[model samples]
Target: MSGRTSAASPAWFAAVRPVLAFSYLSLSHLATARDSHALAALAVGMIVLLLLAEPLWHRRPWAIALAAIAGIALWQLKDSAHIHIALLLMPVIFLLLLAWLFGRTLMPGHVPVISKIVRALEGGDSEAMMAELDRYTRGLTTIWTVVFIAMALINLALALIASPGGLLARAGIDSAWSISDSQWSWFANWLNYGLVGAVFAIEFAYRKRRFPGRYKNVADFFRRMAALGPAFWRDLFK
Candidate 1:
């Protein structure tokens, strides 16, 4: 028998599989929080089973459904507090999970996928790219999703309450009375920087290098310390 896979193999597996797994996690978190096995081993086992079964069916609808169900169950089990404390850890887990199951099968590596998307955004119409970017980020985690939703609601409420003319009228009396266009723009930009910085720092520190997984060296240690210098200064001042 030929070892070659069809063109559809990758799209059906790499792209679709992770999404299905995440869907499973969401359902699990919301609906099966009571089960002890919902979070860790059980979730991993479910993913394994889905992976095994997926190839058998040539990545059919049932394969996707099974994977998604498993992912949702596991996500449902994430501890609320741990979720906040370990927000940076969540994407690594998702990336590794995707790589383990579908890395070889996928056409482009993660970095290349991102690079291409960025190029497309800079050169072409941005609407479609923005939509895909939204989907890519949405696959992040339960905590991130909740936080973003809360931010959106807060911003919407702010917009509704402070009519521009009314805000100008009260600006002389109260700091809170002013919600200018510049203020809204500044808030949006600040949020963007914070989120991007957090993700970038995590990726920079932990991603695998060209070499196989190896211990850090003295040089690497010093380099990390150098990177932290700015943060140390800011903290000392505060």
Candidate 2:
């Protein structure tokens, strides 16, 4: 790990950073105006930046050229309100990416992703300090991987059945089962956030009961998470 924190990272870059990406996705789905669809463009671009910032920084000249090319491409599509369709595919891509990140850590030799984050946030013997906590963390990592993959699959199904330009509609195929664009948005954008937040909250409440001394409450746990600092998160995937 480089142990280097830069302006590229802050508290949001850590545990709950998915909210940063997911928020844009939700808003993009609610879009009804052309300019609003532009939000999708911005959202997707930011996701790229978030994931590749370090590599981009390491190759500054090439990054500059790529950014310029991307900007021009976006400008060319500014008139297309169909950009919001990207939101239909956004969750599938984003959640699968998250699934991969967590799932990979669960492989035989590697540390579970949640276990690593807990250790970093604790800055001590997080797993050892509590009985079976390591086992719990490993299980939690598996849960996240499964959860994200499930969410991605649901989004894919929704994208396929959604009308007014969905996969089925575009193919001139009609199905007895289908949903409206707004209805799809209702799930992909709003319901998905509720589900994710509920999961996090449920975990916190359960942890409070299971691991009483580690945190005073949920807020305290989040505060500890924030205090992990940028360096910990910057090196997380590496």
Candidate 3:
């Protein structure tokens, strides 16, 4: 597979995903008071599309049905605080699930997640390269597992302290630790994603420094990774 062109993602999707993501996240903050049904519906639709993108792209029947159900539910319950709470839980659940996925692969008999990806990407062509990456990949997988768990815990904590109606405030505990709803949204919806991106960016930089000569340049590395195709990603998660 050529790094530059093989099975690459669409340029339009690359641009639009971020825009839709931020648009919905920003609207979540705006809808914090649970007063803007229209705004909430738009955000919910964007989120549904984002979540269903992979299955929709693959034209899966069950995913389509689930998306439809989610769409109807969001439309009906857009004004409810329950919708907001559910949205808040999405990040937490997603992170913890990912943490479990990565952590499980590190068990005694199972292949570590990063090791498996590296092996698939390398196409079983080089023993020496695989040997070099084995330990590093395992350690990197551990780091990712830890990062995901830590982020999920932090997200949960913030949700608990989110004021006006969060667990702490609802219990009549007006402590200094309480955070505003808007602040919680900023961290949960925005900064959490940003931090994940930052981690990837920093790791990319360090990988280039540590594994010099493995990739031609930054673009080359990204192209090679992207060439892995959507199917590889879907199956890896499964």
Candidate 4:
């Protein structure tokens, strides 16, 4: 019984860690505008997770200390309105990071992200339909890169327009051209996800028409994509 428990410990921790991390992130976002205490707790939790769970931080004690200090500072300032600055920048940074991820893979000698994903879905058999799959997946990767870039830009624009005494406002731009904070929040929090889903649906439709042999139906394609989530994350982190 002791031996079995010892063997299962690491496996159980590996399975639970990501779920906890994701839940913390989701709750952080949801509580950002509504509850300062929750946001602060989430921020500290994330910092602790990074320090304890991430391999990169294990060897860098300075980095861990700095991160903890930053987390503590943020937590201390959570009750202030200035904390909203971090909240506003979160989506913008996330979109930009995604754009960078997809764009970086398009460089010379690098396999496109979408191509890697499709290859993973196809059981790592690149030789099965090399020519067609390569071309289509590269193009799909470009599409995703462009989509993420566009989303990032739109989010930035909305944030700028909604901010009081922002660059545009300081430059004598008309108030009529500026957006409200609520409007910006709507786009950053909700419509951004909607637009991404819309793009995915549109891309799937285009793929169906362009590559009939790839998937039998939209449902099958989405199902396969869903199944590739773990592989995608593994490839992403690697």
Candidate 5:
């Protein structure tokens, strides 16, 4: 019984880690709209989680100290008007980071990120299947990069247009470029997710048609994607 419990521990940790990490991320986004104190707490929580989960950070006491200091500073400065600006810019920053992740791999000498994921999923498939997977995955990577970039740009545009003291205001442009803050918030917090979900559904449909031989049903595809999460994070951080 002790041996079985010990053997199951690693598998349990592996299964729970991604769920915890994603929950933390989602909480951070939700906390941004609260107050500076909430955001600062979220920041510290993330750093603590990272240190606990990633063995490499265990030896880096200085890094942990610096992060704690930064988090404290953020908490101290929470009442500043700048904190509001940071909250407003959060969606743009997240989208841009995703864009960079996908776009950077598209450069010369780097395997497409989606292809890397697909290869992990395929494991020891036949050469013919691999060749088809490679082509399809590369195309999907390109599509994802474009989508992220577009989302980032749109988020940025909305942020600028909603800012009363931003460039558009200084330029005396009072058209659609001067949208309300609530409207921008609606897009950033709500519609943005809907857009991504819609795109994912559309892309799944396209993939089904484009790679009929390689494509499985949506449920299977998602299951494979879920299985790839652990490997995905390891590759991403490495």
Candidate 6:
């Protein structure tokens, strides 16, 4: 390997990224809300959903898959909740997990991308390092870039086909019934979660681990937050 870090990286980016993304998504949707009541209801529902899903994640394969499918379906339904935040950002989480699980296996043998970027950012690009970065990127382009492009196309197709407006409408909410503001808010949130969930599942399964480090503080925080109860708690009583 080009270089090995004796210690895991700080949780700087991981801690902040999700919050910012979630805020952007929520605010963007709220701006489209026709009534304040709807926005408030959406905020409440979204918080509840986030609390519910956070603990269920646990870096599991099935949870990841369900998250993706649900998030995508919700997006299709035009839901505006933060549930999609988890799903949409699933790719990053998967990368982090992969890096933690198999960091040694996924990183480049020499002059890794991080080092090069840091060096460039700090204005310290030696000729040898540049050549190494070039070599590494060239190899990466040859081996994986095309595959990623193909995967992107596949994801797009899946998203379109699985859209809530398309396949999920078959679930058959009564079209004649006037949807209340709260109901609309709830629907928007569900759609967001479904789309995000789908992305997470897909990325977790397909993407290579490039992020480096063990579980960070924020990940642990969210993991615990998500784990509010047993997965079948709601079903067991029935």
Candidate number achieving the greatest TM-score relative to the actual structure = 2
Put down candidate 3 lDDT per residue, 80-165, tens digits, no spaces. Answer: 65666665676788799889999999998888988888787676557776887888889999999999999999998888888874
In Å, residue 37's CA in model 5 sits off its true spot by 7.5
Model 4 vs. true fold: TM: 0.70
Question: Compared with the true structure, what per-residue lDDT tens digits does model 5 show for residues 57-79?
Answer: 33346665766676676676655
Per-residue C-alpha lDDT of model 1 across residues 148-193, encoded as one tens digit per residue = 4455555443433333322233343344554653344333324434
Ranking by lDDT: 3, 2, 5, 4, 1, 6
Candidate 2 lDDT, 174-221, residue by residue in tens: 867898877777787778878889998998889878877888877887
Better of 1 and 5 by TM-score: 5
Instruction: Give model 6 RMSD, 1 decimal.
Output: 17.9
Residue-level lDDT of model 6, residues 1-238, one tens digit each, is 1223223324352344456447544643463344333343343334334533442333445556765665555555344443333332333343343334322323556443333333333244568755655665444433333343444343333322332321122244434324333333333434435654675455433422432232244455346434533332222212
Ranking, TM-score, top scorer first: 2, 3, 5, 4, 6, 1
- Higher-ranked by TM-score: 2 or 5: 2
lDDT assessment of candidate 6: 0.40
Give the C-alpha miss distance for residue 175 in model 1, angstroms: 42
123: Cα error in model 5, Å: 3.3
By lDDT, the better pick of 1 and 2 is: 2
Model 1 misplaced regions, further than 4 Å: 2-19, 27-32, 38-42, 49-92, 95-113, 120-238
Show model 2 residue runs off by greater than 4 Å. 1-23, 32-43, 46-59, 123-131
Clashes per candidate, residues 3 or more apart or on different chains: 13, 0, 0, 0, 0, 28
Note the Cα lDDT for every prediction shown.
Answer: 0.41, 0.73, 0.77, 0.66, 0.67, 0.40
Candidate 4 wrong stretches, greater than 4 Å = 1-67, 123-128, 163-176, 216-219, 226-232
Per-residue error for 31 in candidate 3, Å, reads: 2.4
- Candidates in order, TM-scores: namely 0.25, 0.80, 0.79, 0.70, 0.72, 0.26
